[model samples]
Target: MREEIIVSGRNNPLIDPLLHVWHWEIPVYLFLGGLAAGLMFFAALYTIRNRENNYKVAVQIAPMFASIALILGLGALFLDLHHKLYFWRLYTTIRLASPMSWGAWILMIVTPISFIWSALHIKSIFPNWDWKFEVIEELLEFFTKYKKVLAWIMLISSAILGIYTGILLSAFNARPLWNTSIMGPLFLASGLSAGTAMVIWISKNHDERKRFAQLDLMIIGIELFLIIHMFMGFLASTQVQIDAANLFLGGEYTASFWIFVVILGMIVPAILEGLELKGYKIPIVIPAILVLFGSVMLRIIISYAGQASRWLY
Candidate 1:
């Protein structure tokens, strides 16, 4: 005799359970991408302005970090790909509909530009380095001569790269939490904030550090507003969107979402920076470290929270 087994659909949740498709590499990539874009953007802006302090950390050291950060971020992305050996296929064709395609092209364009941007400052960075190599001298001379043009290109590319980081996640309509158009601007603001904090951390010039600290405070304010608006938009959206929003508000990710991202990441950093701006001699490193750490946590929380969200029940 054969026995028949039946499965009860009614006992299961309405929608398929959220799958953990993405992992730590993705969020780390996003955070580093944003940081790199921010550094490049600020560096280009300072170059264009021909600021007297253009050779400061923001313009000099930051671009080098931008290049390094982007390389690491791309490495993380490559590792996340299942077909790592076939990664070259991404360049073989253009798919307008695919965010991954857009990201790959953007990174390809941005990476070389970032390296060239850093090369422009190589002479200033390593004043004692040997310049006997013709190739190195020529590359340096070319970048220095066309610095303005390169700065403009970097400015535009940085903005695109920063916005692309957000759009990459937003493109996933399957995750309502990441579907909002606001993600682009929000991430851009966060990137600028984190980048500003990073420059502040490494900057030796007192005035420059103060200026960046003020800028970061404003960016943090904007980020906070965007966060509020994001949740408000979710509340006004469909049932699926509301359910997705709850994943952060009252679901599994609630504690880390509030503690790590909202409080420690944005609010505390804002207060610390604010105190410093108010003539209080707070340790700049403290806030800078908090902002950078918060930036990373924000990306991690968003990545996991988005993965936990779904459009259907």
Candidate 2:
């Protein structure tokens, strides 16, 4: 008898019919890290917005965390590139039509803007009283004069960063799991949720608690609505799309999607925010940590599973 053979290559029918090579781990890491950085940017922006100086300490510290996330995100993005040497060419050519290209450009713009804004804001808090370099003094003075501009840029960029990350995933229409028009808005809500949650959890001062709680509730509601819309859209989609949805809802990614993303990221946060809004402070900080961890895992699972399955009927 002839030996039986098992084939699972490009010619296999059960395999992904459309083979678009992916750099997987790096892209998913970038997605999660970028959103985390964006969330921190929003946290900083909110501190300035509320005219709350007590919150400034947390805001200042947040950018350090954001900086780490952004650096790791950029590193992942760079690693995903096949030709790392020609990466500079992306900056030279601005293609508005391409979301990946546009996202790269927007991220590039936001990162430095955030860094400068964070630096100026920090300088405002810790003023250099040394009578050493006149140039440094003059520069600091200049920054003080345009502090409002920096704040505005920071706020606007936070918004852009929040949505841009989702748009980056939605750009791939072939992947029905990520092609939701609601994703951009959903991402913004989730970013705000994570951002405000972080600020609240890290806050030493009790004065800003109410405002952070309010922000958390607002973001949670919006996120819930967007998730509903996303699911509805998916359920109403074509066969291929439904197949894609199964990959998350009932397929391989079900556990992560339900446990981490839905239960922890959404449900726990909503309940905690609700209690917070009702002025019930029975040590609600743990839920905030849970939600933050859930948000990170959600990004990883969604990015990974959305592209992991085969779409053949």
Candidate 3:
């Protein structure tokens, strides 16, 4: 006979086997944040590379979606906050060491810039778009004049935002499932892949769509590589990380993560896109939807699984 007692935090849900404090809000926010980051990253990348004319949807149309996604993500994040009103205090000072602080500042800058970039292209989306105020008109000109600078800012911030989504979890060292640094790059690659799939689904130009599909394929490859690398690293590391890895390898999350995220979300999309590139008539929307679906599932699974994992166990 053996008896053991463990004492962690006073009243932490992560310490409790049956309770989850994060709920759906954190996962939703993570998905949306990653999606917004990926969308804006591509938008800024093409704009900087002078491919705006070539990739109209990536540069002009996607930023609007990114802005909307960011706002919705922020709303989800706010809803998940334990103390919502004190959220404003996060902006009172800059904390370089905290991923949450970095995320807050990045969102503050990237969110408005996404909206501004989208607004600058309002004429393209709505030919008769009107400026309701003189100040809005003036602001548009200033943004247009310094659009290159804005793109640079977006590129940097969006990358940070993408990585921050994963870093946020990795920072919680108690959760072995997310305690690895590889989590950041893996999330970024997944987000970028999702973003590219979105542009492929929305673009009207066949050439543009085809080009982005190729790019998406490349990113998907990288994302897959990162996923495998993450598990390999975990298996080779501590017993705790290995336990965490087992949750996806052969445990309860195995089927969902592998089927939804790995097979349907990534491999299926890659095959469809690959066939499309080879002159097949596969509906781009199918692959796009699968990718988006997988992205959402990935975040949700990670959030819940991380909560289930603890050092005390």
Candidate 4:
């Protein structure tokens, strides 16, 4: 007689025939987290280069957005938690191998730093703003005194946060759609591109807008390149991976991915920025809005599509 042992678990809950776990909350959280990371990254970057004052929006304004985005993102994450009361247990220990572990700690560290940085600049953004709380003033003063150190820390933290956004998705090796290392850089590029577009929109100075537009344009180019490479990698891999790529290439996500994410989001913005650089009167907000819209949509599509990429079905 021949005896055989059968594997008990070869199925996926996410890509089941009719069971979907995550909802809108997850994609919203991811988009906002990436956006906040981008804002903080650029804010710290300008401060480190001593160009913060020149780019007032980058330093003063963006941190405020970052702070708000972090709060809202965390709120969205909380809503998606199956065991909401047990969420704090994530802080009890660190797991270097776990992407969720890294993200939890990174988000905790980043949230406070972003809020404090924004608070420090409150006076600068609003001259008439008055709060005479003694302890608060002292804390802000201390943060201001060592702001250079804070900026450096923020630069590193923000970069990690931005990369973490993608790593969270890609680390799920079972999800063939997001199983590539390129997701890290691709998401980072998307975040930086959105951040730069916001800076361009907020800046009142033509030269500042122009400089950031050039930077945004360059990042968009890099983003497109990475996207192409991601597809090439997928197409060259296994059948499941190729099926995953087809989701965006010519499958269900074809129109959404190509039209909203690729064309309107990156290409149109690139064209608008180029025209602006070429002495045309393109409204800066147009490109900025398109970039931001695309960023959020990309997260939503990726989050949803990844869940559908498993071969169990």
The candidate that wins on TM-score is 3
Every model's TM-score: 0.93, 0.83, 0.95, 0.93
Write one digit per residue (lDDT tens) for candidate 1, span 1-313.
8664344543334223555778899999999999998999998898899973743889888889889999999999988998889999999999999888988998998999988877767767788867678998898788788889988999998998898889999998888889999999988888888899889998888889888988898999999999999999999999888987898788988899889888988899899888888889898898888888888998898988887787443
Question: lDDT per residue, candidate 4, 1-313, as tens digits?
Answer: 8654335754566534523677889878888888888888888988989998688888888789888888999999999999999999999999999998999999989999998999999988799887778899899999999999999999999899889989998998888999999999989889888888888878898878988899999999999999999999999999999999999988999999999999999999999999999999987899999999999889889888888888554
Query: Model 1 residue 175 lDDT?
Result: 84
After superposition, the stretches of candidate 1 with alpha carbons farther than 4 Å from their true spots are 1-17, 52-55
How does residue 16 of candidate 1 score in lDDT?
36
Q: Which of the two, 1 or 2, has more lDDT?
A: 1
Better of 2 and 3 by TM-score: 3
Q: Residue 90, candidate 3: how far off, in angstroms? A: 1.3
Candidate 2 residue spans exceeding 4 A from truth: 1-50, 123-134, 276-284, 309-313
Q: Is candidate 2 or candidate 4 better by TM-score?
A: 4
- Residue 84 miss distance in model 3 (angstroms): 1.6
Model 1 vs. true fold: TM: 0.93
Worst 10 residues of 2 by lDDT: 12-21
Local distance difference test values of all predictions, in order: 0.87, 0.69, 0.89, 0.89
Clashes of 1: 1
Q: Sorted by lDDT, highest first, which candidate order results?
A: 3, 4, 1, 2
The ten-residue window of minimal lDDT in model 1 covers: 7-16
lDDT (Cα, 0-100) at 224 in candidate 3: 91
